[model samples]
Target: MAIAELGPVVLDCPDPRALAGFYAEVLGATAEGDDEWTDLKVPGGRDLAFQAAPGFVPPKWPSAEHSQQFHLDLLVKDLDAAEEAVLALGAKVLDADDRSRSFRVYADPAGHPFCLCAC
Candidate 1:
């Protein structure tokens, strides 16, 4: 038998609520929970959770010194539209130069690296 079922992917951020809100908007989910911890309920998939990390320093993108420990990949049919929406939602472009590429990297409000991939 399998050892255990998977749980929500948890991320540490300075403000759990704010980070959860960011992911909620990106994933088309609802943010739930309290100040110290928050969860984004993603339809047809596992949930994403955010936990408060006092004095949290966001990981550096493409840096060997401070590697991005993890990243989320979101599939989209329209990369341009998705990019615009995420930028409006406070996501910063980490890398998007190669137009031919199937994916683009962005940093959420809390500075977690994530990708918007062509579906």
Candidate 2:
């Protein structure tokens, strides 16, 4: 038997509900769960879960001051459009410099750094 199988990647945030909702919108997934725990379910992709972490400290991007154990890389057809949409969904730009790059970094509402890749 296989020793382990991949499961939903869970993120620790101050508010599970809020974080789950943000990602759900970003990934076009559905958010479901209680306050302490939330899951973002996509139609044909791995699911994402969020859990409430008391006194949670948002990760510092491009800095080792606090650990960012995990991050998601979302593929987009148009970086400009995706950037606008994500910003509207409460995501903040962390690194806008894309000069001849395929990906750009951003921070979600809770400050988790993620990237939008064109490749």
Candidate 3:
């Protein structure tokens, strides 16, 4: 038998509700929960959760010292549009030097790295 089934991907952040809201807006989901814990019910995809972690330190992308613990790849139809939207929503560009690549890196409000992929 399989060991376990996949569940919601939980991310540790300083403010659960705030992070949840950010994802909700980006994914067109709803943030449901309190400050301590929040859930984003992603439509047609794996659900996501956020938990409050006091003094949480976001991982450094492309860094040997503070490596990126994990990252989310969000598939979008148009990279330009998605990049604009995410940037407007407080995401900072981590890497976007190559225009021919299928993906671009960004850091959310809490500094977690994520990619907007066109693949």
Candidate 4:
């Protein structure tokens, strides 16, 4: 038998519903779950889930004090457009270099780092 195949990824945050909503908007998915847990499913396949973590400590990007542990790499059609859209949806640029680069780092509303990649 083969090893376990990957399923959905779950992120821990202070508010599952709100965090789920943010990912839902980003992936054009829908949030489904109660106050304790929420799930967001992308149209094609990738799935994301969120759970409420009381006293959740957000990771400080570019700092080893609190590691990010994990982050999502999102493919976008246009970097500038994606930047604008994500900014409107509560994503803050953690570190943005020259536009000529293919990827940029950002922090979600919950402070988890994710990358917007033009690939």
Estimated TM-score per prediction? 0.97, 0.94, 0.96, 0.95
Q: Compute the lDDT for candidate 1.
A: 0.93
Model 3, 20-71: lDDT tens digits are 9889989999889998999899999999999999989899989989888789
Q: Name the regions of candidate 2 deviating beyond 4 angstroms.
A: none
Instruction: Write the residue-wise lDDT of candidate 2 on 1-119 in tens digits.
Output: 99999999999888899999888888899999998999899878899999999998999887777877788999889998999999999999999885578898999999999999996
Candidate 1 pairs with clashing backbones: none
Candidate of highest lDDT? 3
Cα RMSD to the true fold for all candidates = 0.7, 1.1, 0.8, 1.0
lDDT of model 3 at position 45: 95
Q: Per-residue lDDT tens digits of candidate 4, residues 79-103? A: 8898999899999999887777899
Candidate 1 stretches greater than 4 Å from native: none
- Runs off by more than 4 Å, candidate 4: none
Candidate 2: Cα lDDT at 96: 84
Report how far residue 38 has shifted in candidate 4, in Å. Answer: 0.1
Angstrom error of the Cα, residue 110, model 2: value is 0.5
lDDT of every predicted structure (CA atoms): 0.93, 0.90, 0.93, 0.91
